[model samples]
Target: MNSTTINLPTPLELMIDLSDDQFFDLCHKNRDFQFERTASGILVIMSPTGGETSNRNIELSYQLQAWSRQNNLGKAFDSSGGFKLPNGAVREAWATPIRSPDASWIQSERWESLTQEQREKFLPLCPDFVVELRSASDCAERTGEANRLKTLQDKMKEYQENGAKLGWLIDPKTKQVEVYRSGQEVEILENPTLLSGESILPGFVLYLTVIW
Candidate 1:
């Protein structure tokens, strides 16, 4: 991960140095707030998702979980699961090695390859699949803010750069979805009723009615 500055409008940032253990402990201690870090070790405090967004997130997770169980192709993770990116500098210098996607899935083979200790810590690899939902605070219409949406778009690009096979940036307010695939242009779907997993997931298809 490269060190870059992101000028956030809210939930002020504080630059701090904490080891992985320290950071993990801090997260548990302050369970009420969401936190993220940059590759340069700047700690970001994320606001909680609103009720509507939270509900939609639950549905999204449920669908991914159901499909994962039936297919047994990979493991599904919720918003709480933090992962350590593989392409990064040493943790001592930059503690921004961890990130938590709203929803993610890792192929079974890659998951099985992790040591128990590594798995217990922040997962040391990018997931095969990732999803980013635009909450009320993130929606352009709701807040009249483009930064949040742009931030998410940048995140999707980061995921692709870091080796994620596929990603989805779902914007509920606009009923639009931006599909990200490795080495390809982003495909935007307007008011999509269903999203096909394509070659990445083969037969898996996500119905958007519940989300809408």
Candidate 2:
């Protein structure tokens, strides 16, 4: 048996700028792939997750969704959801970039404020909370893992800078979690069995049994 496939053009890194509409259209044209645009209009192509990584991601998203539905406080989003940032000169006066987290949540009030079109497109606002899970690719080599850890740490900082109240970088390989929050120091939890959502989530507790 053979699987059907489309012959995509050879991937290339071009420096041409793209308007928000053009970028959105580009994303729509290639929905099968993951795309991220940086503040400088540099496009990043992300590979799809492997089976183990996808399984772990689903578990995380499911946990967040259940919690959100029960509390009725926010909306949970999976890896496919993207958010537009407010920095850069990509789109004239409305310069911005796009990013997606492995899992995220936006507060009810903030989410409700968005128009139907905004909700359907890349969210124009940052999520209230975000989570990044480390996959096998992130820890395949000692040097690479160290560099990836730094990048993840930086990403958590970026989330805080962009208005995320809380964030977590969970590394199954090291069995550790790095917590990030606005106006607080980064907290490292080693081999933690559970993670508390603090005042931001108010009664939410993330158990790490399935994650590990």
Candidate 3:
């Protein structure tokens, strides 16, 4: 008797033919596959899927919303707010990327003035604050957790270098958060008290305790 093995196509391979907009829509429709655009091309990242990350993200979103409302910071979002970078035109977060962040925040000025089509096509502007939560599926390989962290770091650097006020990288595994402030060194916080700037969120204090 002879046995045969069948090969399966990866999601990225299946999506190679789609335009950027169509690709984004497809990912949104599926509600899986954390997605993002890189310097190279569009990527459909695969990660261990579960509810823990989602729950944490929801919690973070609520915190941000409360902070925003209390401080009049305009609006905050999770992975939903896509940003336009200097190099590339648009970059949106994936729905369930390997290492999904808990929440992101955008300043009021960025959201209020839209170019009509821009509001419909992409996120109004780059957010003032970004937060990423580590997951069990996060690991280091070609398409593993390590790569995800690197990609996220690069993107955060890009945003900060451009005009973003601050960014946060949360690693639940390590119980630590890496804070990125424009024109300053990346600070690792085990339990930091620093809050977001008035230029960004005014009176909002991003408590790392909530994330850890």
TM-score of each: 0.87, 0.86, 0.73
Error of 2 at 86 (Å): 2.4
In candidate 3, stretches whose alpha carbon ends up further than 4 angstroms from where it belongs are 1-18, 47-49, 88-101, 140-148, 191-199
Better of 1 and 2 by lDDT: 1
Point out the higher-scoring one by lDDT: 1 or 3: 1
lDDT by residue for model 1 (1-212), tens:
89998756555578888887898888888887777766677787886777998999999899889988999998999998887776552334445456788999999999999999988877888888999998877764644568778878977877887788899999988999999998899999999999988877768888899998
Better-scoring candidate (lDDT), 2 or 3: 2
Q: List the residue pairs that clash in candidate 3.
A: 34-96, 34-97, 35-94, 101-132, 139-145, 139-146
Tens-place lDDT digits, model 2, residues 1-212? 99998654222234557887788888889877777776566676666767999999999999888898999998999998989975532334234768788999989999889999999899998789999998886776743668777866766777777788999999998899999998899999999999999988888888898889
Off by over 4 Å in 2: 1-16, 88-95
lDDT of 2 at 120: 89
Please report the TM-score between candidate 3 and the true structure: 0.73
lDDT of 2 at 53: 93
Q: How do the residues 103-138 of candidate 3 rate in per-residue lDDT, one tens digit apiece?
A: 776667777776767766546346667776666555
Clashes of 3: 6
For model 2 the local lDDT of residue 106 reads 88
Among these predictions, the greatest lDDT belongs to 1
